[model samples]
Target: MTSTALTDDMALRIGLAARALPDTSPARLLAVLADCIGLPPNAEKLDTLSIKQLRSGASGELADCDHSVLKTALAYLNGTASTESMPPPVPQSPLINASGSDPEGTIRVAIASNNGDLLDGHFGSCERFLVYQVSADQFRLIDCREIDDRQAEDDKNSYRAGLIADCQLLYVVSIGGPAAAKVVKRDIHPIKIPDGGAAPALIGELQQIIGAKTPPWLAKIMGQPAESRVRFKARALEE
Candidate 1:
């Protein structure tokens, strides 16, 4: 092997050996090995000794040197080596509401509305729903879109079955009875909002309700007692 490769290999070997022994100094071990094999300027110089000299064993002091120094240095080196090379363990973040009686799983909430501005009003004439995952202090919006006639039907049935399969909570905000009826069979709790109110205002109002008397599904998803008031300023919808 080239000198660089040999040095790397030696370092890796020393590191591994130190880890295995847990009480050895890898430097000392390398120093002892270098001394016994007629390599370098002894234990003191082992740290800076080149791998080329170590592999060649061409140093002149190997014949007259005492073996006891090599042995003792090797032992001491093995013991101390581990401290320098070991990686620190990664720390984990604590889960929110870990002690709650709810099922050990994630909570999802779906908000269906007639407001087109929620999705930048892309589907101008269509209604939309925003699905979100509730956390201890915040809610993460996951999916938002307008569901067409066919898609609405499919989603109503499919969402119910899927949620039932996964045992997830389903919350639907609908404009009227027809759309609400589509998912009513799923036993989903429907929250009604005025078509005239802005999305942020509606959300703020709903948050207030949840904070005062949280619904069973919301309670599990939120995973924390709500303290702050939900507030927002109104914004005019674009034509």
Candidate 2:
């Protein structure tokens, strides 16, 4: 692998490891991490900041982990970071209510989840998928599929992708490069939502867009009706 790739991988590893430790503060984690990697110069008082705060600080403070490491590390910390250390999926919201119907012309989106609620799981690690049908003004919970744990890695990813094959988009906290490729090959767009967002929060944002304008990409695929666009513009001008 290239030097940059190596650093990125290391940063992810460091972030996950740091979050797993108990009673560990971000500042202390950085201090220990620095010492292990010969701790860069010009780094002072970093051990006092939270992982979230540290990412916003200077590159000089990060020493070697600056270039590609800081952002990825912080993403892991913010989205997947926890002292629970690979704990089972805990729902951050209420149980989803799916009607088992997919509305035509709506984008079919899938989210990796441990619970029946949030997009707080990795594509490879999450055992379940929450499927949503998203139109411009509304989104509906349509289906839920759970993977069989007995499958091997090769069997698992592709199989999981197949379960939600009809979906146009997939969301997850993280996904391995290979698994992401597999998802894409099935014609599904994979979206990485940082900070492990709640499913309802994300759905609400999409609904707001439907009420406003259709994004270029979605417009291209779903193709808004000409009359509706004209009507929407007329209303906009009137307002």
Candidate 3:
């Protein structure tokens, strides 16, 4: 990756990791990380670093920092932090009061989640999938599919894909190539959220895209009429 891209990606990870360290700002974490791993931090470097290295690097200004928080910070940086260490879950809102009735033009979305109502889970490691039926005007939580430990031990990625087989879209903080292939084979589009956040906000953004001008790929997935697809294509070409 380009230096700018690496720095930007590292910046997002540092921000999340910093949250784990009490009173530690992203800038402070970045400086400490740089001291430990060298300048221009990248994900590959951070993934290889250990808690011991971070503690050893925490000197001068951070010499007196808590070790527990440092370990938590490293876990967050590596995307291995447990749900308990993550930010509190957001409550599910606008959950469907009625079942088996979906609005026209709606698509089912599976959000990889470790904490409540947040798109903070990786495809392989997230605790559950929060399923939502989303349309241009509204969205409602339809189900939450918990991962089965037994299945995880054997062919986990395929098992996970089976859990959300009905969903047209899959949102995850990160997904490995093999896992992504499985999802795609099931006709589910996988969207990676580098900096995960509240599920509602992300779905709202998707709603906007659907309402305004659906992309060609999305249009196809939504099964828009041929004329509608042509119109969308024309509009996109005009831009």
Report the number of the highest-lDDT candidate.
Answer: 3
True-structure Cα RMSD, model 2: 10.0
CA shift of 206, model 2, Å: 1.7
- Please list all clashing residue pairs in model 3, or write none if there are none: none
Give TM per candidate.
0.32, 0.52, 0.63
Q: CA lDDT of 31 in candidate 2?
A: 60
- The clash count for each model shown is 12, 2, 0
lDDT per residue as tens, model 2, 1-239 = 32312244344445464433322334555565454333431223333335444433444344333222344444444443343333233323223347645444577778887654777666765657888777766666767777675664546678778888877888877666777899999988888775567787887776676645665555444556767767666776787
Query: Which residue runs of candidate 3 sit more than 4 Å off their true CA positions?
Result: 1-101
Query: Which model, 2 or 3, shows the larger lDDT?
Result: 3
**Model 3 per-residue lDDT tens digits across residues 153-184:** 66878989999998899998767788899999
Off by over 4 Å in 2: 1-101, 223-239
The residue ranges of model 1 lying beyond 4 angstroms of the native Cα positions read 1-107, 113-125, 150-178, 211-239
TM-score of 1: 0.32
Residue 145 error for model 2, in Å?
1.2
